[model samples]
Target chain A: MQDDIVLKTEDLTKHYGGVHALDGANFELKKGEHVAIMGDNGAGKSTFVRQITGVEQRTRGKIWLYGKEVNFTGPIDAREAGIETVFQTLALADDLDVPDNLFLGRELTFWNWLGPFRFLDYKAMRQATIAGLEKTAVKIPNIKNTIRNMSGGQRQCVAIARTATFHSRLTIMDEPTAALGVQETEQVENIIRQLKSVGEPLILISHNMRQVMDLVDRIIVFRRGRIVANLKRDETDGQDVVAYITGAKGDDVADVA
Target chain B: MAETSHGTGGLTFDKSKRAWPNELNIFIALILIICIFEALGQLLPYMNGQSLLFDTKGRFDSIFNEARIKIIILQVSIIGIIALGVTQVIIAGGIDLSSGSIVGASAMIAMSFAQTELVNGNPNPKAIFGPWAMDLPAIIPVIVGLLCGMLAGIINGVLIAYTRIPPFIATLGMMVSARGVAKWWSRGNPISFPTEDYAWIGSGMMPVIWFVLLAVLFHIILRYTVYGKHTYAIGSNEDAARMSGIKVARHKVLVYTIAGMLASFAAIILSAKNLTAQSGMGLVYELDAIAMAVIGGVSLAGGRGSIIGTCLGMLIFGVIISGFTYLKLDAFYQEMVKGFIIVAAVVLDQWRQKKAAAKT
Candidate 1:
């Protein structure tokens, strides 16, 4: 397989009126790479993902998707460009059913205007939804159930299924298993492993050191707004990562390598 | 296994669908209203008590008085038009208290345009309008009314969505301002004697027809269309809706605008039916319409209710009024009862919400 950089960000920065929410940051991911971003509460880990995924605009930077420089104005734009993000807040509409939530903004329309008027092609969507669930190996008794009725893990699984169903080129998950219990978290981890086997790139923003160590191939550390250090899974330990998050390193000056 | 998820889930799964038991409260209230009238009929000497639904004389159709039923429906039908718009607003996590004021203002403006020239040479003295607006087609007034509503809705939407004002405050500001405009239009005197064509639009059962038609249309829109989905999405969780790529602000504007237009349309019907426009025509209509929405089972918190519920609520309102007349209840008592019903409906809604939350 040709070595291709599936995603790249350069000099990405965001400022909330002098807060310097995200200072200059640079990152890269290969087509099948699994990367984990680790940082403290105010380390700008979320800020970086928010900018890259178009949840928030960068004050200055360029995001290149598949080698083309991109500036997405909104999350939908990023989604259409094959980037699906599972935000920390779990932006799923609780009122909607599993299938409806899966194909919410991007509803699979049949017969164009004619079918939209007659029926939603629920059968097609349901079948496809089941297939998507099977691919993720996330079992649910029925697909007709709403997110409000589902467990936290089940809801998280449904959210992940959306990414899998769309076949997004890159998936950005922010604390996907934080709120989940042991069994549910294990289920999510298995799904993550399945994604790894499928050669799909994933960017996991997580604080769980064990999860980060187990699921990702590379660790990218952030302090304040800039990327402080980059380490491969085998090369670095958790203490080294924590030292950077705590700003113990004297590398305060941001010099892009 | 220890229960470790968000909530306990093991329970007997009942296949029979859960009914809105709150609807039963409204039903019980309806029965109680009938009993009140039945008791009053026993004490009152004037009340004949020939039938609960029929008129005083107890005649099947004629003496029973179709006009009374028509009047109650007619009264509600006009404001019910505004309610349709308000429903959309509420569903989208907003409110439109200005709808009633929009009605008053739009009625005055539309009537001014729909004025007829004194054909018999009486020199129409009540004419605040010029000869250019004289004897225009009925459609002219309707279009004008609709436009007025649209303008009010757009202003409310812009203020709330773009300016980031709270819906209640924004629409309340419009409410006061619109009513002020209504009073200023003819300077507090009633605008009388609309053109015959204008009068025909709201005359007889037309208001009811329009109300029903608009309600049905909006009901479908809320249930089946992209607009409907977006409305629920925003109402349920606005932040999530925005993150989902919905143009939240623009859609909000459209929803409020639609509401404003509905109010204006009701205003047109009101002025036409009465053949007169008054500054106080739509006073207190906002409350009544809101009461109807609440009584119909619409959750005040938003994202949970139906148009069918509103329609049923309107029917209940009509029935209660009719029932009071059957028992020869005082007008003051009827008002008191209506007030109580509104409060009861809200309480029932709260109870239902609590139940749902408990389930979660």
Candidate 2:
């Protein structure tokens, strides 16, 4: 239980029947340290994240967040514990507008003055959403328009903005720019950079080598359900990370030089 | 940013040129249908100068035929309650075929509790219980009906949510099972001779009043509450909703339970209105309610509709049926026309959805 350790997972293992999706993964993230988890498809990077975020329960694991041992039953539990996540699907209600999507599970509601009736504080939520968007520099033409009407880039920005809206202790993004265009991807990367400047810890899961190399303080590569390499940004290049991802390097430790 | 078009399903296609909202489109069609009926009344030789719904004769208290108006509203009100629940369910991306059967079961069970101790000067022949159960309070019967509906709904919700069964299959099973329960309750016998207290539940325009009140309440809930937001979210994208921390399964169950309770309420109204209840009381009511929601612009694909739209659709339904009867159309022909209208409304909704999709 160390205050400096933002997130720590000990021997996290997830088994889908007899198949091992993620196995005995040991990982750690320091406060305000931007980290990347990179691996090829089916290399269990997503599975590992899912377990940490409580999208899927691990067979055995102990997750500590902000120096407190926590076991999330589902994504909601993880979220309530101050772990904000932008899932691969973006997890946005497409029929809802930008503000509504931003406040999907966490809405501003007040009890009726006279009765037991509860009312959603749409005006307040809208203002907060605007302020949050401005904070992240994620702009949309209209917050009234539903997500279905927005372009791909706008939808992604809204998703990322939602994670930023609340003061999350740890933010996890799974392939945040996978479907984004060059400009949209750049926009997302800038938001990530803003998070770094604000001294916020981040765990970004991506296959984009350039993105991982450019945005993170460290890279953790996964191969066949296990963490194969943990390399500091100053000590690793794209070739070394790719080799680890492709399982060309077997050792868990890599050269620091 | 410049383009703004009102599309069907309450969606605004900002990039498209222009089109009417689905609700407005339905409204215009409603007026057109009325005009068509009016014209037919004047054109046909058998009509004898009688209008479909207007004050052509000027004999009634108001412009419209008061009796006909009463009948039309009453005809749709009881089932309208069920539509409110179904609308929520559909918006949450599920269908309920068990509503009609739930109506049947609830009506029969509620009526059994509502029986008087005496029938026409003799001991109650239709009584399903002992003297202690006779002539009980109206609240007892209403509660019984609601609980029965709630039980059925819970079952439907649990099966669909926890078991991961498709909504269609789970509700279809409930439909059959509930119908069987209705028939078995009194061995297919009809229950009648309710107490005065029970009879007052659906007397006169009470059913219509109930429908309007429930519609308004649910409208507010759907438009200005978290419940409404979650329903739309789940229907729009279940996976996204779950990831956002919605209790998808629990919400599904809650939706179904409410739907069942509404269906049960409809049954109580119907039985009270008729002063009788039989196993066949709610046959096809589910389809009729679904049709109303669809006609009102409720998308079968989920996550796009409104209470106002459904209410308007109910009126349209009532008017069409009344118009057909007034025109001296055969009952058989009316059924076919109703089916056609349902299909046409869905096709219209589809076209609107496609237009919006293309614009974006």
Candidate 3:
């Protein structure tokens, strides 16, 4: 049963002077589970995700991925360890086309047998990008278009598609559907469901209640930089999560840490 | 983040009125400037009508005034090489102020090695070093100049990338220090009489040849290589690039080093052409090269420049200067007009960016 946990963070904390952006956050995601992190704007939901994804270093924490303790100094370390992230900003180079964005740092290089003479395998990257987008059901008609020329929904889809390219042990999404339309939100939900079906663990940070209820298997509610409730999908409703988030109920912190 | 999401609506771009490539617009601007000069040649109240770019009388080897064209190319080529490196630097979201001084400093050091072993079958009179260092192979001075440039560039890179000194300040410091080194070497005296082989490097149209070759090579690198991608990525948004796992610091260092080496090579060519090395050889060359890059369409804002644009930029620069001289414009007026053109080019660049933004 312990082997099923894909990600676990022990006593994760962050501080900025007198402000505790995140204090003693403890969470876990099981293999094939889809967990939604929910809270108000300043409740440390994004901060908790930041620590696990190595977007920022925690003041103190022990992150265990695949049952081994790891300290990721930066996002690159976490990414190389099979932790893919869809940042709120998407992290795409706006001037580059879709294929270039998809393979920004980890580009496929051909003629590797010739050492420094190795060149970008653009054809291979393009094909792989097409396949990834198709698998995610993203409908980008012109793949050569740069990100600066894309719609909000299309940009979000490209980010999701990029994360889907490799064998990811865990995927962390920060407001993946925040800027999307209703139809696009539904499409993203389908992609998250597919990830669940394929036994890929997920950590989705979202504010949309309806989408969260429809897409997630578990809910972790935060308030005042602390975890207030942990409820299974069938055990709680939107109102119950909101109570925990707003301190109308479940004000006593859960033994989450 | 808001700026990047609104994609360029590719289908709509084709339907819009402004469908020409941006580089084409620059080309048209260059031609328009030529026409303007040609009209001024006819309109000005002078003793007689004259031609700026065309041969008024059949007195040269080419359709154009061969001597004047040669002078324009010779003047632009050395500076154009530096602009190539500056293009990369600006594209990487950094500025280099030391390139001119690097030229000066490297010229002094390299020319010392390029001195001929003999003076009319006697021991060399102007040798900077003992005979052991004199009469060295031509490659020796070329290597020395390039290494001096590389070392200066590495220092600039380290200061900017690792120490977090702002690029302008760091390279500015290098500028002063490098010029100082130039003056210090050979105690403000000029070094001349390079060997035949060394002199041949810059003799008669060779600088122009070298400039064109480097321009093409760098154009390919920026267009098709991973290094180009990373450079654009860094300039476009550095924080985003770092998050994406591109080694931002190392790449920045490499960009500056390459820029340094190019400036050094420019210095070597300058010395070879003049057949001497003076501490003041490359003064203001940095600013000229930057002006060319900016004029060509290498956005100082970074991530949005190209080498071909810089080449065209050099041409525009050359034509404007030569045209001014041809019309017998006062040197003072020429300086003022050149400044005006640089400002106008930047304004045009900003307008294009705004139009692109509005379309999205």
Candidate number of the best lDDT: 2
Q: Report lDDT per candidate.
A: 0.80, 0.87, 0.86
Residue B120 in candidate 1 has what lDDT? 60
Q: Evaluate fnat for each of the predicted models and list the values in order.
A: 0.20, 0.43, 0.35
Candidate 3 positional error at A213, Å: 2.2
Interface RMSD of each: 6.2, 7.7, 5.7
Looking at candidate 3, what TM-score does chain B attain?
0.92
Kindly list the per-residue Cα lDDT of model 2 for residues B233-343, writing each as its tens digit: 999999888777778898899899999999999999999999999999899999999999999999998989988889988989998999999999999998999999999
* Ranking of all predicted structures according to TM-score, beginning with the best and ending with the worst: 3, 2, 1
lDDT of 3 by residue, A98-217 (tens): 888888888888666644235788889877876676556665646777776777777787788787777678999999988788887876787787777777789899999998999889
| TM-score computed on alpha carbons, candidate 2 | 0.89
Which CAPRI quality tier does the interface of model 1 achieve? acceptable
* Candidate 1 Cα outliers beyond 4 Å, as residue runs: A1-3, A11-24, A59-61, A108-128, A140-142, A224-229, A234-257, B1-50, B54-72, B119-125
Query: lDDT of candidate 2 vs native?
Result: 0.87
Model 1 chain A scores worst on lDDT over the 10 consecutive residues at: A110-119
Q: Write the per-residue lDDT of candidate 1 for residues B91-176, one digit (tens) a residue.
A: 78787788889989999999988888884678677788778878888888889889988998999999999989899999899999
Best candidate (score: DockQ): 3
RMSD of 2: 4.4
Which is superior by lDDT, 2 or 3?
A: 2
Instruction: Identify the candidate with maximal TM-score.
Output: 3
